[model samples]
Target chain A: MTLPILQLRAVGKSYGTVRVLKGVDLDVKRGEIVSLIGPSGSGKTTLLRCINFLEAYDEGEVWIKGQLLGYHSKGRTPQDRDSEAVIAEVRRPVSMVFQQFNLWPHMTVLGNVAAPLVLAKKINKTEAHRLAGLALERVGLAAKVDAYPAQLSGGQQQRVGIARALAIEPEVMLLDEPTSALDPELVEEVLSVIRELAHEGMTMVMVTHEMSFAAKISDHVVFMEAGRIVEAGPPARLFGKSATPRIQQFLKPWLDRSLSI
Target chain B: MNVSPEHIELLWRYINAMLVTLGVSLLAAFIGMAIGFLLNVLRICYPRQLSIPYRLLVWLIRGTPYFSQLMIVYFGLPVIGLTLSATQATVASLALYSSVYFAEIFRSGWNSIAPGHLEAAQAFGINRWQSLRHIEMPQALIFALPLLGNQTVLVIKESAVASVITLPELTMTTGEIVSATYDYVGPYALLILCYWLLAQTIALAVRGCATLLTSPQRTL
Candidate 1:
């Protein structure tokens, strides 16, 4: 069995007694595309942030490629480790693409992509520009390298965001509803990029509402509701006969519309 | 009906003197901006230690009157064994005054930086320093430029105070020529016109820079 690139064992989080995620266990193996399907406020985004340690987990262990991220005990005071050390490791190994496409407005598309390599990795400018060009080309945004983020459309900006992530050469890519902010016409452009990455066997965890795309692209589908995973299986099993009543109820209206159309 | 040629010569001499004072004001403004830039970098990079001292300095400068401060340096410093020439004292006082305004200019610019950009920089693994250099400082300066330009104009107008120390600056020369020639209207009116013209030019330059520096709107 391939060792999982990322594993969260009993990860839990809360904001002043309002529990956001509880006993959330997930394992994402190398080269696997995992789709996390959940309704709004179901802890999907929180879980993704937890993997990168952006949101502190109140309880449990987050292990990345067999390195224990941290061990938090039940009802124990949190120890303050230097976030910079963990941040360097986390930033090196993983990159997250946000829903809103948080591209730096002041930077050009090439500058945005080249920033992480130069700023974080200390890559030289010439090499950084080269890698940035490669990343932009991979996202079909080679022509927009010199364009500022403000000059790009929503889909183009999101693709630039993806390019920025790819420029870092991370092992795992965490996408928190990457295309949800795009218009329907623009969604396909972003999804196609994601689909190509999936085909290349890049490890990815996606929180998405795109049922058909999830069914088509995900190796495993984990259905979550109210801060817990309600079902987990291969996409075929989950979307076909074995889809639980909750998922069925959730997808019924949309599924019926598609069938009628 | 005839005015002394000496008085006419004084007017010419005063115009040259006024030019020097204008140059000094420009130099002070530039130095104050540089110091403010350093202070802003320190505030962002090392906020805990530097902010207190920065606040204290700005407070002391702004709390006192600029003219009195000039007097303190030119007249009072001699008793403290740190005697400076009248021109030097005027420049130092103007720089001190401008720096207070400059620091405030920087603080406003610093606050204007969007937190999202900073977080994005942090997430990219750029340490604090790199983020400020690559992201924050450039962006903040865009917001800072107009206020600094306004302060520059204010510094030029306030250079009139330097004439009190008998520095032979524009305003003082105008006063001397007016007293001797008994024609307050021409010299003083001309001085006002010159100051207004300079202030307007600074304002125009600020407007031009503001247009150049406004970032394009982001779709994301």
Candidate 2:
């Protein structure tokens, strides 16, 4: 019985006056596939961003592998930000895949994947390139290593995005609506790559709308509304006759769409 | 001989003047870009520290005419206990005058990038400096090359303003030669041709560099 790899305690974030996440608590153990599903503006994406300290939650604490993130300690103000070196060390194990693919347009596929390793991990160029090549090959993009992001299709670019994240060898991957920017046909290709990572016991916290995929792959499905987690449990509990009205109501549209398909 | 002695001296003067103009333009362009890029970064990243001062400077510079600015640096600055030579004033004033436009170009370039691009970099523990260097700046530069290139070429033409200070650049040399030799058809026509060719060369060089930047593999 080891501790969870990620722990969120009363995590809250606000943009000036409007609060986006409130008292959100989540625990993700090693190799856990946690899927956050909700309607738009539910703070699920915000929650995912908070986990990586990308948005910098204003209140409470985010614990990655038992080390506090964002502030110096729990229940601290945003002003009590940690030093960059400390923040860097704390979040070193985290990597992200963005909704927009977010591949650096100036870099080729291989260069895009190799940059973070050299930049973040301080790996030598030769070693970083080798690791990046392997990551690309894992995502099945070896043929397009020299191609620029603009030259690749959306699916291939997202795969490169995945490869870049994977190259850093993070303990947990934060995916913010990974397929939301893709065409319907392209979504499956990205999903398949994500699905492969999930099956390989790669720990991931995904913000997704693929209800059937979630139902099939997720160990735990969290239903969020407004700025809080309304309900969360294993897939059977959340998806199968949800006890919470909000969870059922949220899943109803997605369920119907999936069922009809 | 292919050319007469008097004609050779005139040609030599023209070449020297063209060199001065080219030197001033290139130096000013690069210095202005470096200042603009640093100012843009400071304002964006530390708005509280830099915003008001930078805004005041930019407003003052952008609001004034380049000729007056050149005069102020060359003439009026001596009143402020900071005298500068004609060439120094030309380079300094042109650099300052164009810095505002270059800053605006850099600002647009930075904004043109999606937030996700920075976020992706940030999440992987790529610090602010690393993210800007590896991910943000290059893309912003590619976005800004055409506009930045335009401004650089414009500086060549704008250096004509320096002639008023008797800096002996192309335009000043043309005036001097035309007055001495009474040959408007030769030096005047040559002045126009000199500027035309200089601007064209810079514009072509910038386009070639942009193509290389945007598509490096093909160039390789």
Candidate 3:
């Protein structure tokens, strides 16, 4: 019961010769918000993906609620990768929201949220729809359940994305630049939905460029650069005078925009 | 076009031949899609074991001419003690010939699905079977429909190749009528007309299915 909801130790991944995540470590306790902030191509999104085993962590261990993910043991050989059933079981408590709002284009908003419940959880359709309704209500999308993803505006589609993640009742949700794909005017609606979840004590790890929102909502802020965590701590430390000069330089633009710091 | 007794007889003969051709084409199309779907699934889920060999099989089938393939089915297999009736050989050969291209269509269909979609499915811990059925297959079918319509027309036309084995389908019947009356133009015209009508019917039907399957969720 004391274990952190999600744990990663020295996790590393390489796409052939290109190393995408290099020896990153972090812990997210229950009811915590950790925001990964970095420049483009700095592996923030890859690190979040590794937590769900969406991108395999080839070099280290990820423990979800005390169970190791991806591999059956410490061995990193291809043979050591766990079976699909095993990987699915280990990652069952995790869910993800995508930058592209990867809602199935062929499904209505209700169908999108209820899909994992039906397909992954094997719950009956009626019950799945009922739970999906609650999740949609949470994101204020209850009225749009019958609508298709493309029928909705960008912010509305991403809310459906959040509702899909929430419908699974995930122990932790990974958001890969949740608002990045939205038009500038539409970002706030999706962020408000996320802010509601944070207030309700949702455990989440988000990769975001929303400097002020991340500063406002995050309990722990991590600065990453070139595939490694460069600096991380409480928001005040990371956003204020104690930040590394490199991290400061990275935040300088947002700082000029006058972050809450 | 004056209505004559000989013309009525020719029209009747053409109708019977059209039925036979439809039977063969329909049977071949279904079998080809089933085999192609299975072969595609094998390569995707078991790439290390089956990918190279299946790719070679698909390539070999695609490269060979249909006429020679039909000859092999009709003549070559009998030499190895696998004899089949002429009609059986026609359907079997056409099915085998088209399955590889169907496999290619399926591969392209799956490839057209965004990587992000699969990643989201995986992140939810959707089982492999469920993911295939619910996530990948439906979307893939959307991409495959137009290609499938194309393959359907190709199979109908290619059934003409079965005339060499004397299966008595439309093309074979045309040859017989041509020889009997020395009337090349009328029987040939009937042959083209029958195939053109059949192919268009199927294409229209496939388009109907596409609309039915996609309309409710069709992004506005």
What are the candidates' interface root-mean-square deviations? 4.9, 3.3, 3.7
lDDT of 3 at B165: 82
lDDT agreement of model 1 with the native = 0.83
Please, what are the lDDT tens digits per residue for candidate 2 over residues A63-121?
Answer: 99999987775446756888877888999888899888888888888888998888888
Considering lDDT, where higher is better, how would the candidates rank from best to worst? 3, 2, 1
Query: DockQ of each model against the real complex?
Result: 0.29, 0.51, 0.43
Q: Candidate 1 vs candidate 3: which has greater lDDT? A: 3
Best by DockQ: 2
Residue A240 of model 3, lDDT score: 80
Ranking by TM-score: 3, 2, 1
What does candidate 1's lDDT look like per residue over A1-261, in tens digits? 778889888888888989888898888889989999979999999998887766777777788888766432344246643356565565468888989887876778988898898778889988999999999999999998878888889999999999998889889999989989999999999999999998888899999999999999999999889999999889998888664789888778767877899
* Candidate 1 Cα outliers beyond 4 Å, as residue runs: A70-79, A237-249, A256-261, B1-15, B50-53, B182-185, B200-220
Q: Pick by TM-score: which candidate is best?
A: 3
lDDT per residue for candidate 3 within B1-220, as digits (tens), equals 7999988888898999999999999899999999999999999999999989998998899998999999998999989999999989998999999999999999999999998888788878777787788888989998899999899889999998888888889999999999999989877887888998998899899989998877755321
Per-residue alpha-carbon lDDT of candidate 2 for residues B1-220, written as tens digits (9 for 90 to 100): 6788988888898889999999999999999999999899999899898889998988999998999999888999999899998989999999999999899999999999998788777777778898887788888998999899899988889999999998989999899888887889978899998988898888898899898887756311
Q: Better model by lDDT, 2 or 3?
A: 3
lDDT at B9 for candidate 3? 87
* Two-way DockQ contest, 1 vs 3, winner: 3
What's the true lDDT of residue B89 in model 2?
A: 95
